[model samples]
Target chain A: MIGRMAAAFAAGLMLATPVLAADPPAEIKIGTLYASSGRYASISMPVHSALKLWVEQKNAEGGVYVKAFDKKVPIKLVAYDDQSNTATASTLYNQLITQDKVDLLVADSGSVLTAPAVAIARDHKMFLFDQTGTGASFFSKDNPYIALMADPVSTIWPKPVADFLTHDGPALGIKKIALLYSTNEFTGTQANAVRKFIKESGAPVEIVYDQGVPTETTNYTVIINNIRAKKPDAVIHLGYAPNDIAFLRNVNEVGVKFKWMFSIYAGLETELLEKNVGVKGLQYVYTYVPPSELDYPVNFGMKMPEFRALWNKTFPDGKVEFGFNAVAGYTTALVIEKTLSVATSLDQMELRRAVFSLSGQLKTLDGTFALDETGGQIGELTPLGQLVPNEHGHLKFVAVYPHEVATGKPVYPRP
Target chain B: MPSAIRHLLFIVVPLLVVFAILPGVYENHLMLFNFVVFLILAQGVNVIYGFTGYLPFGYVGFFGSGAYGFAMMVMHAHASAPVAVIAAGLAGMLIGLLLTPLLRLSGAYFAIANLASSLAVLHFVANPALEDITRGPYGVSLTATFNPEAAYWAALVVLALTLGVVVYLKNSRFGLALQAVREDPVSAGMAGVNVVRMRVAAWLASALIAGLAGGVYAWYVSVFFPDNVFSGTFSIFAIVFALFGGVATIIGPIVGVLILYGVYNLIGFTTPQYFQLIYGLLIMGLVLFLPAGLVSLVTRRGRHVP
Candidate 1:
């Protein structure tokens, strides 16, 4: 009887004692929005695929280390399609916050969709990693929870374009400027930035005509006639791909002459522009080159060659070639991983502080990952590129501005 | 029980009950809010297309106008949500009145004209030339009146009112006259029906319902670009739901929404292309086999649908 009692007591004690958790969490749940369908799908789908690829690569390499848990945890992405609609994006964001209980919130695409999420993230006190949203309004001292990880603000995008015109316009006898921009936020911001810079810089430039056209403007004939009447020395367009393509085709058909021509989003599609406009047609057409096109040395585990190789392997035949959008997505994932390494806890506040502390300390494939107090990217700068003919008689984007990054000289006055 | 009372008990009450009780039973407020929106929109479509035989291709015009109406009221007039919603309904009615002239045209022409008008409105609202007033393409954010709970309940109230209207249409002599006008305007005129007035009234009422739904939607989500509210998908879904279930009946749209929207939420977001393909096939099948809608399957032997 005594022996049995002792054995029973020992078993009860063993059962009552708690067992320590041995390994780190199997995965960290990261939630993001996606425009899997609708208008923005063509641009957003590739970025999302690249994001998945980055996460898969990290998991393959034994997962990412979390300083908070002092352990390695693989990432698990919980994504919802917003259908490229702002309301849907807002609704999905609420779900991500209240139901999914995501550890982090990353934006899908565009300022229009992501802007509403800023309020949601602030309300929930969740750390938001903004990807493609480049609205200057997104950054403010009032909301510190949001951080811009990819794409420079649109306000600064036109600065380089303006700088080129300011320095080279007079020398090339370019006196008058005609600026037309889409009415959407992205193009509107660029237009405003250009105006502000020109007005402040006092670059001896006369703005002959400036107007904002509807984003869905299919016919540019009337506008083109008005612009043709203006007889400007230079013409600059700030718009999306479709708008740019339509305007370019119209200009080509109308035979509008300009000493200089620059468009914001045209360079993103080098191959398409080459195919549509041809090498001769593209002469003197200027655009800003995305970081992915630059032959920069490897930084933060990514180089242009290696990134392209991986992209080809992963997508195989994706309609989207590796460019700004893909590189931005990959860089965003790297920034998230870097933040996780420094975070002391999974708590949103701690994570946000860690991200904020990464201001000038981190470097990624894009450039130095430095952010201002309001979460505006202060370090990364895009290089300007102009379409020039190669030996093969094909149009290729050649870095042409800001002498240091210039791969070829600017060929002014289409010859 | 009378057919009207039967519908109220079996269809209307149950739907209202489900929507009202859903927030507590299920924590997905966004999903529930969307249900209220579609319910109101589907019933709105039934009012015009089902009864008056006018296909409203740009039905989302009223919705977008209402959303902007509510936002402008709150932003400029500092009006309360209730007041804004009233303005929203008025906005839709006003736009409907402006578009009443298009009713003179018949069939595809009217549809094309209506679509063009809606697109024109979208461009006008989104134009930076009007930025000072409408905020242009930058979108509107009603952070001041951001209350999902209130918006959800308001949406339910709108649904209830819409259902009441559907019930009235299902049972009233005026509705019968509208149907007569839809079948043969000359015959309805000969039968002493005020065909023009009745059609206009139904058109305005349809616009009002969608407008109110839009107001509540804006209130619920609290932020939207012009594209968000003016999307053609709303018109397509509402028409499909009404057509799929059976127009002219109270239960059809409700049933259509519950089944089709349920499927939409299940797989639509995850794999939209596949879901779209499936949805297209189903719509085609419905048109070919079930011409009278899903309700016809039950009411095929000369039985009344609701």
Candidate 2:
């Protein structure tokens, strides 16, 4: 009886070996747990599509060489939706790591959703590259496995906006300013960062207003009335798409004017501006970004067309409007390509080490940023960008910061 | 000994030993602790529905508010968890007492009222008017409960006590009275049952259990952001387990939890989530054909088999 049981046990152990020994695929496939569904679907679906496009483009040109395999291996990304819910995102991230055993992971939008996924990545000894969803605190926190490709919310156009303030516009002597931000995680991060920047400068700060309002409340008349009453030097509003449009409409309709009106993220997403804010509404809203505006660096103004053309030809129909978000989305795939290129071996540890090393020296379309230990990108970039009228009567980039980058001098007092 | 008691000892005792050794389970299995917390919560819902026949579609509100209330107090005041548990229970009781007036009404109005209660609380907590106190949209985390095992043990203890309460209620005159009301309100009233009083008590008991579970969960997860804590998922767990596990049978919930958790673990439970559709299909089938639940179907079959 004992001999028979031992024989059965040995058989059971032998049977499990096949499943365990089923080595992961030769190609480095990253099963993505991004938001391809839910409200965030609009943002992530395009991002996954754009990422796949970049991968195809890279492969067609030349494959990424893996040092481990001593050969080039094509990368594959399998995408899924989190429904923009943290629990679901957490659950999906685990599946990607344990079952699918994705070579690498990409984070979905929103810090609230990404936090748990980051913990899971750390546990599984996998690299998670966060792009597009900017939350400054993620960079502020310490983690090894997670790397930052996503521009931190605090740095969402931080350099251009701040450069405009510190070097360019400060000399103009527009003293007091009013600060307004869409009440959300993204805008809150920018609002806090900007306030910190202003506070340290001691630039005769105005008491106009620095407040946040809900996404609802269609009528900004009451709040605008309050802001108009304060009558400070400039009016700054931080928001994304709809709020950006509604804020501009309410303030402009009420005839609220300032020397400068600044905005954050969504103000810079060109499509969001046209389809939502339109040209007339967002005429003078300024946005801030690091000197390296696009994900791929354009040291000179000349690079914009090639970048635009390549991006447009790739997604052609996407040209009605595009901004840093798409660029950041595209950059995530670029990071994977570069990571695979540097890894001397297919071993997970070697791949991770190569990524960490390769990422530190990356010069992206948006300019160069050093990848730090916690996986956040750090670039010595001048923060500046402003919104101006495009020929189509919509808002377009009018650099108004860092004196050097300013396309033209500041347009003060509204028009 | 009764065969049922023998069955309980055979099954429950071993399960107890396994749960006792659960802290040593792989780190990946930590999410199972979430269901232990969920079981306690579902039991609370069971009291309101199974024992008293009150369909509450909005218990998530009570659970969330109780959690946030207890967690914030502990964070701000540096209170102990044991103390916070009681405080959370009291907070839920207060909400139940406040909502008792709605119980005087009948029909779909009760369902609407319960759902409305959750929405009202959600709006109040989410709005900026209470921003200073609740921190508005930004939720407070329970940083104090960093020890993983402590959280698991705490959740387990609370669950045991809640089950004890359910067992006690089952053997009492109150349980008989509650069933009497559930069967026929007019008959219960004619027989001198204080239906309103009994319903109110059940609501209070349910709220207390919900509150205790919420506090435990908040501490266990170490973070209880408002939107996530107050989500409809909380209420759905209560409704799903009860309906799926043969409502009114106390042991039915344990079986429901086992099957549901197994499915969750298989697909939706893992990182790359895919089982949400399967979950919906399973629940839909249960609702459409097996209205009485899998347990009831087996029992009904057994009665006819002879």
Candidate 3:
């Protein structure tokens, strides 16, 4: 009886041992909200599905190994459908962090949706890894809890376009660039950033027409006609895939012409553009993404390529874009994995510290990166990608910007 | 048990359950306050749609006014929530009093008028002339939690007081007069019942409840904007509870509100997006089957319909 009592006491001590007393946590719970069932579902849902697949692949390899924990721990992703409603999105997201007790948080798809989530995360001192949301204010607003997984839209994106415009303008016999963007906070911020970047780059950017249109407006013939009438050196419009697809179809149909032209958003969507307009139509377009950072040792990071391969094998008929959306989801999982491996159990404060300390290379598909103190990237940079048609007709990941990541030379007067 | 003890037991049963799980159910005082706001609003909506004969479709309109009134006063005008609540009530009373003419009309007209009032308020809020004052659509933030416990306690007090008043009115002369107006205005008028007066009073009282609830809700939610404030769904939810509980009884809306709140939360835990669909279907079913509502079945045999 004495021996049994002693054994029972020993077992109880082991069971009751606090996570902090032992190795760091082996698993972390990430709460990510997205437009899973609403207007933004087409893009956001794919990111989520891709993310889930990445997590499964990681756990399959015995989870992430953190130096802090010195063990391989798995990852759990908790996603909520924002339904494209901001209020519902805000309330539900708050509940996740405060009530459901999630380890870390990931941003919802849109900027409007992410703003409140980011604010709440900052207030509570949680690491909010913002992936899909690209609004400039996210970076502008002083907060340490949030990071720009998708490089700040207003910060870096406009710079390259402006640089290319300035460098190639006089050389390529092009002069004027027209800026068009939506009225939303993210697009507006980008539009403003582009304008600022153009002036800094010594490019003559005459915004021929700056009109805000409603989200539900279907007919873009008039808008395109208005732009065509401007007849600038190039036309750069920023919007979602649906809006871009509609505008491009109409622009193509009307044979509206421009030189070295680019668009803001839809360039990243491979499937939507191909199904609607072929890759030939999308050739020469450039969009921003985390410099498809060359892969390193992290086993899960290596699995991204295989994940894409499996996706290709599973749905050969489908074509997906190689933009930052896929990277966003993958990055979130990476951050979660890192957090989990660093700790023995998912505790908010410990996970928060781990996220803050992420300064060196992160093995995300986007690239090796680190979130700075302000939750912004320290040295991580976004490189521009050109839509080069693969032999299979899908676009290749050909980085053509920042000179260093350039695979192919610029097609200056891209059609 | 004494009569009071029996009634007290009914309340205690749930109180004990909530007390047992309060720690797990709520993360902090802020969330508890949020629940309090919803509870108060549900009860107020119950009073207007459940107790009164009027179909006040613009329940949220009054609520919006109260929220903005408080938000505007405290954050912008540098006043407090307590003062803001009173100010919001006064504003609600003024609006309700102004709407006295519409109460002369019955059923659909009352609904249309109330709807028109809310939409008009919404449009006015969007007007650029007032944009500078109302902060347009960006909404005014409450800065911080701003006395969360106080807000929660206030909500509790309001709920208890409203329940008592509604019950007292249901059993008293004013309630009878209001019921007479609802049952048959012409007959009520012939029986020396000041039908219009009772209705107007009820309408004003209902608006008062909405106003107070809205003001409190603003402090709890911490952000007050026109679009969020004047949403028509508030009225729909109010109607759901009123019908669910047995609209005429003081207790009906409260019971219905609790059941639906539970239903909503239950569904919301897993999939929040489809909770509204469930709500819509449930309300439709209740209206179709139990015209008198679930609250009408005070007797055991009445529940045996199967």
Candidate 4:
């Protein structure tokens, strides 16, 4: 009786071994798009380059681990240039799905370029790993193939800023506000959120001057003069990197300064903004404090210090700036790696499930990876902060809002 | 065989069949759809510039207008894709009519004026004050009527119709008269060709073609911003493609789209890092070596090219 039982157990073990060790693919194909040159290049290149760097690093380590196959597999990154053209992006995205048959589909950096991928991915039933497209319209209950990887959704991005204004502004004598934004989806949605939050708060503050200029507006001297006429206590300018550079430069050139000022890119792409607007121009400007500045504790992937060092070593030329977008790209790569490790199969829906399962569980340099029901990122929120010149004469972030993360008091009424 | 029939059987039919059956064999239907869109746009450029000798630098204005026209119909009226597409064509024609005065300025002036007119339209559609209607710069999303297969077939049908128009221009007396007007408007007027009327007709027809292409494109993509449809690259590509083929001929634009666009996709897919540099060099080479376009090669040999 003992000999017969041992034979049955040995047979069961032999049958289960093959099922546990499934055949692995030779390489995991991750496809994505980027803008090499054009308006969006400043934002797109850093994200794409960071992703490329992660791919090279992993492949150097003999590849990432895949749980389904019980082995490590090399990563093959297939990227295409959209040239910042949506039609071209649409066609290339389809090629990635149909022709290249990439295992993972990642979108370009911004909302305009990523818009085409949102629809195309759904049509083809391919899951899209949206990098930093924070458009509010992209998230809906019907679409299950996408998730925001890095930035918070635009609708909620202005919460900390708005919270600072409504809760803290009345005491600081910030009675009037001026809101100026570039009329595009990312900034426009943030602008809307700011307006809603301020209105709903029922605070004593009022938006004295509210207007939107074209996204391509380079000369803001006239707009600056126009805003000065309103005499608002605090001025908020929402725009991309180039817009911020131009707006800040114009304010300095025109020799006008409001008591308080805010701009998005001043904090998000600090390196690029510093190079363009100069150190003196960004002094006392309020903006979001990115992860690179905060150095959030990580539970997975490289820590902020290590990632920054690797980035500096890899990109020695300094053509592309390292900022929030650089961190964003690597965060996305980490998510992809984790997803591949947990997914039971290479199927599209299975990949999505694995990605969603990592929500609230994965932590990296970008902060906790959390998602709303519609796949919009709810965690990794950047707190409102002010750029104050340090003793070394270089601008340093002083987190002002969301009391838990406050590093220093805001120096309001800039001299 | 009759000349028009021969051109239709040999050129148009084969092109249509290839695009129709390509989705099954080639898998990338969006690329195929884009090919068809470019083919129609190139031919549209051929119609105006080839037949009337007017270089419309802002031809994408019509395309963008058509796209918005389709969007408005779908978003506000809740019309189906086909109806919205027709509205798109009408919108293009409407803009063409509105800019009819631009034709009065000939040569470089007309081109610049057309370009300015397009930019004006772009700003108008993207203005924040009009956000309630056009959605301003926030963009439009029409997933309710999203049908890629249907939109692809619609694009194919539009391509066929555009080819028919071009073939008619290549063979009919109206075409010869339009060419005469292009060569010398005074002489053509002396010969009783109704120069103004002929120019306007060709201009409207060209606008209609682009408008239809834009509508079909919007339907296929189902989500876009104003910048996507109004991109100056569309106008530039269509003009380059039309000029690269020998223009005026039925096969010239077709050949241009096939060869130039094919090389474009090949470069874009293989080595995307050097895509812009390589494509720029290729265009420069074509301009320097084949000034009259590829059709000139056969025409220079004294052989008729369809």
Candidate 5:
């Protein structure tokens, strides 16, 4: 009996030897930066929360499955506050790469903060999924490790409006155009793209006046005076939410009405604009990005209704509003999940290869993921919308341009 | 112990040793780098405010100017990092000289005017019309000169020079004359002190310190925007740190940075609003109780702390 017991123990020890030889990591580490308390806090904090929620939800469902490890690995997320400063973002990113040893890296917000991370990601050969950093400079041939998860390249943000101008200008008797854009990277890039596009279009449309305004310019009186002097039939304002709202309020106060007033970011900030400028003030103000009410398909795991439900549940009493930032965050998580499923191994280099491998084949809640070698979005097109009163007597963004995505017909020659 | 020996042992040597060696032991080099920056800036504030009684509300202007100066040299001149850092110092002195006219306005007027000057500089750098040179609001990238270790040591060297100046001011008669000017410019002038000249010198020295700190900071971070370097938080933090530790002393700013910046890292990043609340309460308590700063606890009993 003693001899038999000894033999059985030896056999058990042999079985456990292979198991103890290599210890698998407790969880797959996902590291990211968040602008928790600075200028970008409102926009970036939600992205971090959404990413966290995705990880928690995945962990509940037995975590991500890695073929290389041949096991389900739970995600351990390490996030740092960047204080909405690029210097802080770069430092924290370096920490994430070196100290945290994160398996996957993600960017927080727009290109200003994301550009440094893009450079670092390329240098380290780390896979970076940029959530909303759509600056065209972020995806050069030199910096190819990063993939913009959502939002089209900022350069082409004005393309839909350009298309609208080229197609509808002659019929609407809108030929003269005035261009005003904020000096910010996103706005400036869009303004330049629009200028190039219009110059090359050879349409009857003529740009009367073009100028770039500082992002912090609260009073648009001087620019409004210039625009009134030019008397352009169509005025295009490309800027962020604050710039858009401020310009709208300033133009309204100055009584500088245009036949066609197109502004970016204002239409998406429906609640804030309505409260600040009133519902009637935003009527006929056109923008590029689609609003939440649009019947955007559930290409990723969550649809619009489900996303709204999750958003309301997570942030009740309108503490956090649902908008493009939240959608981009959610879509980024879905994309990462799909990428993980397709990746050959858990290695960072292999994961980058996997992102490129599944580029055109995948689609998210936003739209089809068509990224080129440098990770710039080549196929994503923003739907143009005009603000009009809906059945509820509230101003809602109705997709007007591009017949394929138009929820309602656009009203031209503002009242 | 002699004051010079005390400063060398307590202030200078410890900072050099710790900042140099800590990067090896502590893998968080970025955090350490920031700590060094705040230390230099706080001391720079002490030089202007604690020694001369002139509060520089726009100290970050010099710092931001230095950062841009460094970037411009690299981008336009293709100058080496060390050469660019020297130019950055000169740039700060130039800004200081330009703002000397504002010194005629005393107290709150000077503070407000100084603040406006900083904002003006920020707008100038961030303007799109100057995008050809300053890169405008798009910011500057110096990845080529981004050697963190080299920058870290260079920062230590700057800190050493800053502390050396402070130590001299504490021990030498020039510092006593500056204190006299702070107490009464008319009396200092009657006592054969060149009040205007002394004040200008101190102002330029303060600017030089901040400018050098900003230059090293840009090199360390490698990528930043106008808002990043010209943030009002730098001025606020430097002033608060100097005041909290009881300035006019070498050990004060050093101690303030260690305790407060340590607390900041502990709680400031995760939930900043809460940290801001706590810090606000602490500042109120400090003003009410320890008006002379934290070092008063040691100095109140007729004891000199280093």
Candidate 6:
């Protein structure tokens, strides 16, 4: 009788084993915001499109593997358009968290749009996959609900530029510098970093002109004339794609050429800048060497050549251009995919841990994925490079900073 | 019952009760919070443009000032959220007092001047020269003081107060005199209406309502830049909502916000791809067809709206 009773208990335990494991969800809902129009459209559309490409590719491949359920689950993307308005973005972010209850939340493209999501995500205890908002103010020791997935934090982004300016600049006869930036988080932080880096380097360079114009300032004829009066050897104008387009176009129109000109978007969004400012306008301009040009070896996701081919085929109409932001979006998608494969469950903190765990271990098309203790991205640093005209008169990047990666010598005193 | 008391019971009390109970039933408290904010702003517009006949094209200046005021008090003084909110209101009033000279202008001149003033304030706040004080476009992050629940309740209180003021204007002699000034300042002046005082009083009250709303908003978001708070959309949306519902009536702005902003959110959720086009068309149609606003449909038939 005892043997028979033990056999029956063992049979009952076997029957309940399946129930002990968590059931696989029908779909993993990922909520994010995008700006289809207004100020950020040029930068936002590419990132959003790249994210869509990843979603389609994964879904076509029967879905992604989630370790939590130990099975493949389809992705459900819940997205909203904020029209680049912060108040609207704030409302939509709250809607994504409360009403949608998505498993993962991703921020919009730029710092202006992402500012609203940081607070909203933290308030709801949802982890935010910040795409390209490199604002210095977002990361702190207290906030654990946010992590930057792409682009180095602004505090460290300009290291290559500063290093080049201080270490290699004086030898190249680039001593006097004029700094101009649009007054916003992304570029403003970069400007501050550049200033700090130069001062700390104790280089012979002296900053002759430093000024910040409003982000909405479109006319730069007066500002250009002001900078011209200082007669600096090198000029660094930190601004958005639109600001860069206006500033460069104004430079070309006004017929004043600086010896050394550096603008952020000239290399970062080369296609867009070339189309707007024309190939001649971007010639010999110094900018960051984007991931598209670097060809970083990847442990996962498509390589630069494959991704660019796919981006062109997917967006053949050419309304949006391929650039650094395009690469950034795919990098973020890879991080999410890898995180899901390793995360034990869909809990917010668990997801955060899974993300942080991949730091220094994961490599993608952008670069090695790494994060600081405060969740700021510390990897994927871009080297300072200059844009020079190739055989076909189209601009190509020539990495000139950090001598080890130096592809060519600096071209000073534009003639 | 007095007309003001009746309006309060029928309009203000029910609205407040519904909003007060909404967070428990619906999960999207931010959406509800936003609705409450627009209601206050639309009514604030009604107070000035509806009653005093001055179009505050730069109404967002006071709102932005209030937000900065709250930010300064919290960051500098380390004051609690409630005290910062009070300071925000005072900041708005101070700006209103400084611009009192604008009252000398009329019609388009007043409107353009107000708009320019708001833009001026935005530039001043965002200027990198003020980096030490305002953070100068680097943005503000108030993680320690972030209390969404308390801020939502404070917003509700501000809404209730705004509604009460509107109800008083609808029933009191002071309201009548302000409307009199709006209709014809010269005629009202001959009739001893004290045009300047009435207009300024209404303007200051309008500014205070927006200030309180802005303070609560800043407290709720807890992280923002100068651009976010100073966006011209605030002024544009408030004006559009008040105009759509037929300002001057207490319930008109509320109804307009509920219907229009509800549609706005619905479009944003359902068909976001065409949101901008559809919304633009809807506004143009409203102006072309329903020039006087939705309330005009009923008032045209010799009926009181409120």
lDDT winner among the candidates? 4
For model 2, what TM-score does chain A reach? 0.82
In model 2, chain B matches the true chain B with a TM-score of 0.90
Clashes of each: 0, 39, 8, 0, 0, 0
Relative to the unseen true structure, what is the C-alpha lDDT of residue A31 in candidate 3, on a scale of 0 to 100?
A: 80
TM of chain B, each? 0.97, 0.90, 0.85, 0.98, 0.97, 0.98
Scored by lDDT, model 3 comes in at 0.64
Worst 10 residues of 1 chain A by lDDT: A269-278
Write one digit per residue (lDDT tens) for candidate 1, span B1-306.
787787788888888888888889876577778878998999999999899888889999999989988988998998999889889989988899999998898789988888888888778888877767877877776777877788888999999999999898889898899999999999999999998899999999999998898899878766667777888888888989988999988888888888887877766456655766787788899999998899999898888788
The CAPRI classification for model 4 reads as: medium
lDDT for model 1: 0.82
Of models 3 and 4, which has the larger lDDT? Answer: 4
Report DockQ per prediction, comma-separated.
0.35, 0.14, 0.13, 0.69, 0.29, 0.83
- Residue B11 lDDT (model 6): 93
In model 5 chain A, the worst 10-residue window by lDDT is A16-25
A1-415: candidate 2 lDDT, tens digit per residue: 9999999999999888744322334567777766644545556655566577676765675556665555666766666666656555655676677656777788775555665555456556676777664554444343456666646445434545543565445567766677777554566556666777776665555435878776444677888888878877677777666666677778778876766777654344656655665566666666655322433453322244555576677677763335655655666766676776676555566665776786547765656645666556665343455667767765556666565555765677667
Question: Candidate 3, clashing residue pairs?
Answer: A24-A343, A24-A344, A25-A343, A25-A344, A25-A345, A26-A344, A270-A321, B50-B247
- Alpha-carbon lDDT, every model: 0.82, 0.66, 0.64, 0.92, 0.81, 0.92
**Which prediction has the highest TM-score against the true structure?**
6
TM-score of 4: 0.96
Order of all candidates by DockQ, from best down to worst?
6, 4, 1, 5, 2, 3
lDDT tens digits, residue span A44-75, model 6? 88899899999999999989999998889999
How good is the docking of model 2, by CAPRI class? Answer: incorrect
Query: How does chain A of every candidate compare to the true chain A by TM-score?
Result: 0.91, 0.82, 0.81, 0.96, 0.91, 0.96
lDDT of 1 at B141: 69
Look at candidate 2 and tell me the lDDT of residue B301: 65
Q: What is the lDDT of candidate 5?
A: 0.81
- Stronger candidate by TM-score (4 vs 5): 4
- Candidate 3 TM-score, C-alpha based: 0.71
Q: Highest DockQ, which number? A: 6
